[model samples]
Target: MSLFRKITETVSKGVSTATEKAQQTVEVTRLHSQISGKRREIEKLYVSMGEAVFRGYLDKDLSRAETKVIPACEEIVAIRGEVEALEERIMQLRNEKECVCGRKVPYDTRFCPSCGHPFPEPAIPAAEDPLEEFDRQETEPSGLSSADPFVEPPGYKDPGEAPSASDWADVGKPVLEEVPSAWSDAGQATPSFLDDADAVGAERADSAKCPGCGTAVGTTAKFCPSCGTPQQ
Candidate 1:
């Protein structure tokens, strides 16, 4: 009788464990389904909102579509919050936390064993002054000093010093004697080329004679007045 009772108790305990597991599984599955439905609803809202915005853009006025867009956006935000809560509940049910690497680790783990990712640390309230924190930086000393006298660069000369003759030797001087000008003053000596040009002009003026009448005509006369003949 004792052996039979012990066997019956053990069977009942196993059945209870299996029933609890089945209920948890069913609850997780239901949460996932609700999350999926909410996500689908969000997607539909996004599509409708996008279509409305695109229509507004085509119309060149976004204010007219804000009525539909704002409500849809609000609904999406609410649905996302619900999805996040459902995911958290699923994690709790599975006794695991997801790492940034997408690996599920045990809830109490400090770091992910598979990827060696460290979990986020608890936030500590800042006690230091935000403005004064920049004062902590170490500044490098400047190589230049305000007290030092200004040093002249290489090849620099003092403006007060008089220039030497050799300094002026490298500079070019204008040759006034080489360039000839016809407008030289009477006191100035005229160039030889100018004298030659003036002599040639005077000689041509004296030799101009009318070809038809042999009459003396000025160099500018086109016809001889003495004979009424054309002069070449």
Candidate 2:
């Protein structure tokens, strides 16, 4: 589509050039017409002079004839030459211009070979938005306000959603220690025997708790290790 538009723009430019050439054509035509009228006027004068001599009014002067008529003829010829030059310019412009049909499209054309679509119009760049420019100016390397380590991005957590304290320590301090047994109400995740048939399964899960902190840790954890507090 963009390609077609560009071709249309090319054609428009060609048309404008042709319009200028047309003005030249009109000027040339007008000049030629004036020159032709002058030539005819000189010929009439010659005829009148000949008639007067035939009637015995006076003798025909060859020198006078040359002086009066030759310059007019020469001027006519010069005007014709200008007309021819203008004609040639018109033809050249036509050949260089884009055709309405696509079949004879030039090699540089971007539009369709048969249909003229997606023609490009002259581009008028959009004016820059004042607010946008101002916003951009505000966001340079020194734009951000100085913030404390605890300060987070505006949407660090969803609105009204409480953040887990435990997760914060893990993320904030990469080397966080685990909770000790002294920190837990029980030494481990207590079993619920009231669930009856699942008692053994629950006990297995409970036993996997860290012995020192009673916090859940992997079965391979040798001792409670997250926090500086010692294991039970």
Looking at model 1, the pairs that clash are none
What ranges in model 1 sit over 4 Å off? 119-232
Per-model lDDT: 0.77, 0.54
- Candidate 2 weakest ten by summed lDDT: 223-232
Cα lDDT of model 2 by residue, 11-101, tens digit: 9999999988898678667655765666676566667656544554344445555554566557657756765565445445444334355
* TM-score of model number 2: 0.25
Query: TM-score per candidate, in order?
Result: 0.47, 0.25
Steric clashes per prediction: 0, 9
- lDDT tens digits, residues 1-232, model 1? 4445555897999999999899999999999999999999998998999999999999999887899999999998998999999999999998989978787766755555444566766477879885576555435455778998998999888999999898899689775544424444457765768779999888777767767767656665444545546555
